[model samples]
Target: MFSDSEIPFDVIQAYLETHYHVHGRAPTTLQVGEANALLAALHETAGVACSAFLTACNPFSQQLEPPRNLELQEALAESLQQRGLRFIGGIGQHPANGWPGEESFLVLGLALDDAKALGTQLGQNAIVWSGADATPKLLLLR
Candidate 1:
C-alpha cells in the first residue's frame, strides 16, 4: 500500500483531470489510488529502480464478453513485450470495491523515455506515469 504522503492529493487531482480529459468522466479516488499503489509497488518490488510504470484499466463496461477481457489482457501483455517492457503483477478489481463490475489494472515497467514512447503509441488505451515524476503522463491505446 502506498501512503498518501507519497502520492499526494494534488498529484491525484492532476491525474484525475487527465483521466477525465481522456475518458470523459472522473474516476473515484479509490480507482486513482489503486493505480498509484500498483505503480509504486512495482517500483518497490523492483528495488526502486523502475523509471516508469504503464498501467491499463480494462473496464467492465467495455468487456461485457468474457473472452474480450482475456483478449485485452493478452494484447496488453504482448504489446508491452513487443516494446521490450517488463510485465509486472496486475491487480484485479482495484481497491476490492466488492462491486461486480470493477476494473482490472495491468502494470508494466520500463524506462521513462520508453514508457513515453509507448504511451504515444498506445494513444488512450492505457495510462502512463513516471515513478520519478509522480504525475500521469499519457493515456494511450483506447
Candidate 2:
C-alpha cells in the first residue's frame, strides 16, 4: 500500500481534499485532513500488499477513485486521450491528472517523488504548477 509520504505532499493533499467522502462532487479543500485519513484507510483495506500503483483506491469505493476524479474526470480524459493514456473503461480512473490547469500535483503515471522532480528537471511549463500553493498535508482514515 502507498503511504502519504509515497506521493508528493501537494497532490496527496489534493487527492485527499477532493476525493474524500465525495458524492459525485469534488471535496472542498478544507477537508484535506479527512481525505488523508480516507486514503490511509483504503490502503489498509486493500491489504497494503504493495501492488502496482497502490490501486489508488478501490474503484468500488468512493475514497480512492483515481487521479482524474469526477471533479476533473473530463479534463483528465482529454489529457489521457491527448497523451495516449487511452480510454480503458472499467479500469477505474487513471492514476493521475497531467493537465496544465488541473495539475494538482506531479504528472500522472510517475511516482510522487518523480513527479515532483519533473518541474525542476524540465521547466515551469513542463510540470504541474498550482498558481496558488496552499497548505501541505497528509491524512489517514478518520
- lDDT against the true structure, per candidate, is 0.42, 0.30
- Point to the candidate with the largest TM-score: 1
TM-score of 1: 0.43
Candidate no. 2 TM-score: 0.23
Cα displacement (Å) at residue 40, model 1: 6.3
How does each model score on TM-score?
Answer: 0.43, 0.23
Please estimate how well model 1 matches the true structure, expressed as its whole-model Cα lDDT. Answer: 0.42
Scanning candidate 2 in windows of ten residues, the lowest lDDT window is 49-58
- Candidate 1 per-residue lDDT, tens place, 1-142, comes to 2232334444334444432111112222223323454445445665554443333333412334656656765676787667665454333232222323322333335666666565545333344454533333533322
lDDT of 2 by residue, 1-142 (tens): 3253434455444444342121122232223222234223333443331111112222212343345354454554455457643122222122345312222322223334543343333222122211122222322221
